[model samples]
Target: MNLLRTLAAISSMTMVSRITGLLRDTLFARAFGASPYTDAFYIAFRLPNLLRRLFGEGAFSQAFVPILAEYKNQKGEEATRSLVDHVATTLVWATVVVSVLGIVAAPLILMGIASGLDGDGFDKGVVMTRLMFPYIACMSFVVLAGAVLNTWREFKIPAFTPVLWNLSSIFFSLFLVQYFEVPIYSMAVAVMVGGVAQVAIQIPALKRIGMLPRLSFNPLSGLKDPGVRRILKKMGPAVFAVSAAQISLLINTNYASNMGGGAVSVLQYADRLMEFPTGILGVALGTILLPSLSKANADGDIGEYSALLDWGLRLTFLLALPAAVGLAALSTPLIAALFNYGEFNAANVAAATAPLMSYAAGLLGIILVKILAPAFYARQDIRTPVRIAIGVLIATQAMNLVFVQMLGMGVAGLALSIGLGACLNALFLYTGLRRRSIYTPHAGWLGFFLKVVVAVVLMGLAAWFSQAQLDWAGLRSHPVLRIVALLAIIALSAIVYFAVLFALGFRPRDFMRRAK
Candidate 1:
């Protein structure tokens, strides 16, 4: 597959999801404000999200995709289909049990993570927790279906399915807020609805691809499948590897819960802002790279594997660097434009901007982790990344403690600490890859790095100048102008970044255009 082409499809679709997500969050902020109620909902929502990341996106996708690819390549269609059936059967049973147990234990889980929530906040969280529990179970099938589609190189539908998620959430959160006594409860309904839609939207695509598994209830059926066994074996360490960042977020949220009103919401808003470019570039690239890398490794073509890694890294830095710079420079305006409305006012915007900038600082680092960790997983070297991730997690939490507890830096501190820790994690992963000679710097890297950095500097200067010129505070009440101004600035900076790079001879065709 054409990496850039596939990436563009995923990125564009993710961009839609991100845009709709902004609308959802904007509505959320207006409806709930930066209060304990919002915090309670976020914590409640996070319980299933934490598991979704662990089992669905993070560990399961990482562990599942490569194995699926291998089965498709090594075994015939019938065998791979059987393997899929077995895996699907296993996940269906497992997700059901976990969701049931989680629903029953909602209060205990809420208490364990959210000790700082008062009685009402705790009760709200418990309720939403139970409501959102089914989402994880639904998404487990969604993840498995997505992996099968991806293995068949059916990337577009899987990518587009998130649009359903965002749209479902956006519609319910915006329209249904009035009906609920606690408005955020409507959002919990949206979460489950979106989960169902996410799975539903992919079914036709899976059918078209002819890779959809027939549902089987025999859990022990997969127990004897070697592919399933390998997946289960890898999933243990992969969980730790993938769960590390989620673990950090869980810790940060726990810490923020004690920091008084709106603290967690501030962090979530900043994170949402950061995720825009991240989902587009880092996630898009990793999603494109992994299957190809796995195929290369399975074919025992180390050169192709190395080359693909090199391409992914170069593409990552080129995009991630300027994205980080532009985002950090325009952090305040962007936050103001997207979220400063109704109950989410200037104070909330100000509260979120610092952390957004902090998050932007680690943009490249976070993307690097996305790209580099898959390098290990595609090769079935899961333990190394897990160790690296655990160390990074500890360091991040340590920094969080010092910044939030010792220095009392609050949200920005936590954000900065995580950003810095991401850099460290990326560095260690890159260094490990190089030391092992798994990935060597391709020729012209120095020139590529210099040119990209120079372009980023130019983009950064333009963004800073534009931010200084805009009167965001005055424009806040004029929502239309405020949004227009923010978009104008974003357009100008993006133009500058790309135009400068193009002027300096950077071409998309270089890394992406495959040898025909």
Candidate 2:
């Protein structure tokens, strides 16, 4: 598929998922607020999410997809199918053992991560963490299956799988909150169900594609498979690289947990908002480009690979730049519109807005890393990124300690630390790419970037004026009016930015053209 068309498909589905996720968080904030229970719940929820990013989606998908694509390209479909079955069986057995251990040792894990919570709150956190721990095992398998489908160019099912999680969470949060009383724990149950549903939804798609992986205990089969072994080798370091990022966030969360009752929830909500754009634009581009880059590399078409990388980077920056600007400009209004209801008060909105703005600062960096890291992974040079990622992780922890303890900046400090780390990671990766001459932008790229920056600035100004008008009109008191105003600001910003870019020598048709 063409890059723009693929991105459109992925982004449309991801946008729906993100919107539903926002609704899920909206219900969660109203029902649970930022109480100790909610704090504990976020910690518990983050554990599975961390594992999903580290082992399942982030590392495994990055490592698996390129290799699987190459296998299909080289040895035909049946050989790739065998490799998938072997990897699937091996992954299932390993995940089952890990899940058992996780359930058994939940308290120790919870205490280690969230030792700040006391009394029944601490106990409940452990209980919730344990209840949701099995989700990691289940979702990891789902992600593996999804990776297989993505390798086969079946992106729709995998992209839509997250919708199940969001919808399930929203349903349970709305209905079960009143009946269950402990809505946070109820959400945990919903998460487990969602994970199962996420996996189940992909089965028919896989079967229809005639590539449903079967069970196979032959370790030698996978280990001996060149494609599988190649991915395994790359995965070892890529896991560390992915874990470095997640571990940094985990450290931030741990610090945020100790800050206050609501700090964790504030960070969580702000992060959810930031992830909306990142998932829709950055992740969609990365997912599409990985296979394309891999195919280019496999064919020794370095020019095509570089063109794809440059195009991906340009599109990522174009999309994420305005999102970051808008978020930073309208953090308070956006937070209030989405979250200022039920138990979520104005003070809570203020707390969340600060971190949202801080995260917005590194939005480009975040998306750049998402774009660039795949370039390295597509080249099967995962170790270099891992090395750089370790440095980034250490820097993140140090910055967090300095910001949180020395400066007393709370969750916003943690957000700043993450942003700083992402900036450093992107710079290091870009520098490495330059050293290898693997990626070089065209001369006109700088002019394109400048035009984008100008356009984003115009969008920011428009959004600011719109937000000020809404505030002056006192619409913030009415949730419906406030939400409508925020959506309008978003819509206007997008329209103005695109119009400015198109007027400033950026052709919409040029973006639609195929890479190289």
Tell me the spans in candidate 2 whose CA falls farther than 4 Å from its real position.
217-227, 472-477
Candidate 2 on 1-516: residue-level lDDT in tens?
A: 677987899899999999999999998888777778888998987877887788788888889888887888898888888888878876777677777888898888887777687788888888888888889878988888888777777888888889998899998987776677565678889999998998898789989878887876653555666766777777788887756767888877778778878888899999999898889998888888888888888899988888888788788888888989988999988788888888988789889988999999888888888889988888878888999999999998999879888998889989988887998999999999989999888668778888999999999999888887655224446777777777888889889999998899788677774743
Global lDDT of model 1: 0.86
lDDT of 1 by residue, 1-516 (tens): 677787888899888888888888888887777999899989898878998989988998999988888888898899888888888888878889999999999999988887788788889889999999999888999889988887777777777787787888788876777898877789888989999989888778878867777777676787788888989999988988877878888888888888897898899999998989889888888888888888988899888899988988988888899889988999989888888788887888889999999898888898899999999989889989989989999999899879888988898998988888888989999999999999988799989899999899988999899889877766877999889888888899889989989999987678774411
Q: After superposing candidate 1, which stretches have Cα over 4 Å from the reference?
A: none
CA lDDT, every model vs. true structure: 0.86, 0.84
In model 1, the clashing pairs are none
TM-score of each: 0.98, 0.96
Residue 48 miss distance in model 1 (angstroms): 0.6
TM-score of 2: 0.96
